[model samples]
Target: MRIVSGGIQHETNTFSHQPTTLADFERDSGCGPDFSGGQAVFDRYRNTGTIHGGYIDAADVLEFDLIPLICAKAQPSGVVESTAFDTILNLFLDRLSETPAVDGVLLDLHGAMVTAACDDGEAPFMEAVRERVGPDIPIIATLDLHANITQRMADACDVIIGFDTYPHVDMRARGREAGELLVRMIRGEVQPVQAYRQLPLLTMPPMQCTLREPMQSLMQNVFRMEDEPGVLTATVAMGFPFADISAAGVSCLVTTNNDAALAEKKVEELAGWLWDLRDELQPQLTPIDEMIEFAATHDGPIVYADGSDNPGGGAPCDGTVVLRALIEAKFQNAVVGILHDPETAALAHQAGVGATIEARVGGKTDDRHGTPIELPAYVRALCDGHFVHHGPMNQGVVGEFGPMALLLVGGVEVVVSSNRKQLLDREMLRVIGVTPEHRRLIVVKSAVHFRADFGECATHILDADTPGIHRPDYANYDYQNLRRPIYPLDNVTVDFGG
Candidate 1:
């Protein structure tokens, strides 16, 4: 049997001022810079731990011909430019139309993508694919745990499998599951019936982590439900709340073997179980001052997750609130990593290693995060900022932050980069001569993904309540398009009838 597969992935933050463009996708896809279409897709993902990697493995095991097409992804940022969105969509559709007698399609999607043209990006993209493939073709998609699932997306695809783990360690696993299920459907071994529901509740990244409570119990239940007789699969997309779309909230989906009743029942049960814990889903954060004070008195090896300025969630990684406070307090042997400051990084590279250079670092994006820090920084090291992730999440994937410079600003060692990236891996610091394990305090500009790598050695992990677009505080966001009566945003309950 023959199958065609590819997708465009991005997690858009409406609150961010920088609009994502096609140029960003060319440079920052999971497959590396300027990668798209055909054999390049297989070459990049064949042995990797990404969604497409799982697809490749499934193709080898299931013995189905997997035809790869255009799969492009840009860093999480503001809404995509309309021209870029249309260009990629048309390219994907055109390729699908050109394919010969394809039996199925597998999409590797992030599911939280928002463009200038549409708030519900995945729905329309799937609908377009459906239009090209006709009704008989089976389409299965693998999504991030944080998908803002829409009913239209459910209607367009045959099966939707989402990651059960945050830090998203299960990308390849979920992809393999989707592929195996698709093969079953193609062989008439199992007929898939799906049930889906959108919750009237939204949540933040810190609490949505499957490694932590509420989510851990919730995902365990989802797994148990999947083990039941005739249940094909189950997904609990915590949803990307940073999106200002109407579908920006928690959602549940269940697929059963030709059993719509069972699918609906399992989905309802999942949604209700999640809804019951709405109050517990809220995140607790440490004030920057309190975190700094604790670091002063405490021993070594503490990790402060700077989630508010997570570049992965579309916040500019240059937030200076925590860095500025640490500098003023003279925090020593501490490392703050992967700060997005191209100008400062360039200056450090030009000044050479061991040279003390006057550099203005971070907080250059906007006023909401914080003001830029002006200080005399010693250029300790310089690197090309290319590294492979050895962590549980996105392991074997290539990551680039352009050129990077390690600057010693007062007692704090700051790693600045030309590109914006979340500090999720230890290799991100290690490449620039800063060892994370040896540092007294390590601040990562990430929400939860960092835990997959950094949590293993760190003595303590604290979530810092800083200022930026991705902050867990719901009040920081001004929601003009979101559907109201959601949890925390309002005191409301949901009764999604099975």
Candidate 2:
């Protein structure tokens, strides 16, 4: 029996000003032999020798012939450029063609991907791949817990599994599970039947952590289904809201066999349960000014999230709202990483460290959020912005910071980079000479995932209401594509499926 594996991941933020390009992917993460399986894909399943890592280690145990395809994952940001999309997708497809036919295919895809030209990008790719493989061959996929599962993707693949936990500790376990499930399909042990239900509500990532009550209850139900005989696996994806698509909200999926109808019924029941409890999902968020004030009063090692400007969710990481707030609040001992000013980074690299340089930073990409602030600053540290990740998501991962500089403007230390990516791990700080361990206050342009690293030793880890395309509120944006009258968007009642 043979099995094929590949992945393509991108979280599209409909409101980001910059177009996601090949250069962005290259500088942040070096484009190399394993394309589709980069930081998120490879790290999840990367195994050293122990029974551990994150997700990839478990895949090693399952022992499928790994055809590590070209995986192109950029920070969740604006619509993908057509050229960039074609390049990555075609490379992955070409690899699939050359790698030999197989019994099953494993894909790691971000459900909320949108291209500059096309709203539904995952469909065409899945349809194209399905057309080549034929129907009998099973396809099982793992998605971001926050994936916006589209109808096209649901129709093409036999199974779609999402991270049960929002903190997403199961990256390796899920991959191994998918492999085990695929092997079963090859051996004729289980023929999978699937069910999917879309919910009407859409909210931000900060409010969507599965560790909490609403999502926690939802995740527990998914686990309980595994104990049932006919059910092979159960997954509930909250769905990424930033991407403007027809299927942009929450959804629950069930992959089972004996009774497809029963499975679909179960999914519907769960979706309805979640829909009824939609108000509970809204986050108890902190104010941006309060976050700054706390950092000022606190002693050392605090991490504040400018969540609205998180590039991972497709917001222009360069938004100046929170930064401006910090400046206005007169907070000191605060260090900000990744303003994502490429021009400013270039000049700093040219001038070298210890060189005093004055430039405009932040709010450059999207003034809809805030205007740029010019700072007469000194380059405290200069780095190529390169580091091998030592974190859960991208362990053993090598990537460049690509012309990064640590700029000191009065009390604020601005970490600027040519790459538009989130500060997930300490390497983003350590690699740039700004020691992650030493700082009193660390501000990163990321959402929940930053907690994995910063959560430890952090006197306080909090969030800010900085402006960008990926605001937590669902009503702020004009979404023409999403199915009309869904959940929190309209507050209407409708039947949901599992």
Candidate 3:
């Protein structure tokens, strides 16, 4: 069987000030700067643990022809520019039109994406694809765990599987599942029927983590449910609260083999189960200043996660609150990194490795994250800022931070870079000449993804309540377009029809 595969993956944070553009996709897609459409998609994801990587594995194992199209994935940022979205959609549609007859289509989509022209980005992309391919051809998609599920998105695809794990280690698993299901549909093995439910709830990233309580056990139940008779697949999208859209909330979907009643029953059960845990799903955040006291008395290898300024959630990685607090408390043998400060990094690079340069670092994006820290920084090391992920999530994927410099500021090692990237893998620090295991205290500009790599070895991990758009508390954001009567934001109760 022949299958066309590709996607435009982006998680848009409507609260973020930085607008995603075509140039951003070209530079950061992991497909390299001059991203060739066909072979480049296969090359970039063939050996990795990504959605596309999973699709490639399924294609290889199933002995099916997987035709590659354009897979454009930009870093998580604000709403995509209208022109850029159109260009990408047109490219994908053109490729689909040019390809020979295909039995099915596989998509790697970030369900939370928003474009300047539309609140629901994936719906338009899928609708466009459906229009091109016609309804008979099956389309299966894999979405991030944080997708803001919509009725339109559900209507466009035969099956939409979301990652079951937070820190999102299940991209490949879900991808493979989507591919396998699409093949089943094409072969007439299983006629998939789906049921979707959008809950009256909005959840922050910290509590949405599948590794933690409520979600941890909840996802386990989801896995158990998937094993039930006649069930094809199930997904629980915790939803991305950062995207200020009408459909920015938690949801559940279930697909069964020619069993619409079974699908509806399973979907409602999943939604009701999630809604019951609403109170427990609210984020529990510890202020950075409070964490400093605990770190002072504690032993080495404590990880402080500043979720507020996480670039993964579209917050500027340049937040100085955590760094400033560490400096004020005179914490030694601590490492604060991968901070986004192009000016500081560039100066450090120019000054060379032993030179001490006076510069201001971080907080450059906005006032909400905190002001810049001006200090004399001793340049410890410099690098080109390119490394592969050495972690469970997105393993083997190439990551770049542009020009980077390891600066010793106030006896603390600060790894600053010209570009913004969330601190997820330990290799991000190791590449810049800092060993993560030996550090006394490690400050990371990330939410939960870092836990996938650092959580195993660290003595303690605390989520710091700093100031930024990606902060754990959803109430901090001023919602202009979000649908009302959601949990935490409002006290509207839900009845699941038990």
TM-score of each: 0.98, 0.90, 0.98
Which candidate comes out best when scored by lDDT?
Answer: 1
Q: Model 2 off-target regions past 4 Å?
A: 22-29, 33-45, 48-59, 298-300, 435-438, 495-498
Candidate 3: residue 129 lDDT (0-100): 94
Roughly what TM-score does model 1 have, to 2 decimal places?
0.98
Residue-wise lDDT of candidate 2 within 376-468, one digit each (tens)?
Answer: 779898877767767665456666657898888777788889877788787778887777667888888888777766677677767666556
* Candidate 1 wrongly placed segments (more than 4 Å): 30-35, 496-498
Candidate lDDT (C-alpha), each? 0.90, 0.73, 0.89
lDDT at position 114, candidate 1: 93
- Judge candidate 3 at residue 370 and give its lDDT: 93
**Which tens-of-lDDT digit does each residue in 198-219 have in candidate 1?**
8899999999988889899888
Error of 2 at 96 (Å): 2.8
TM-score, candidate number 3 = 0.98
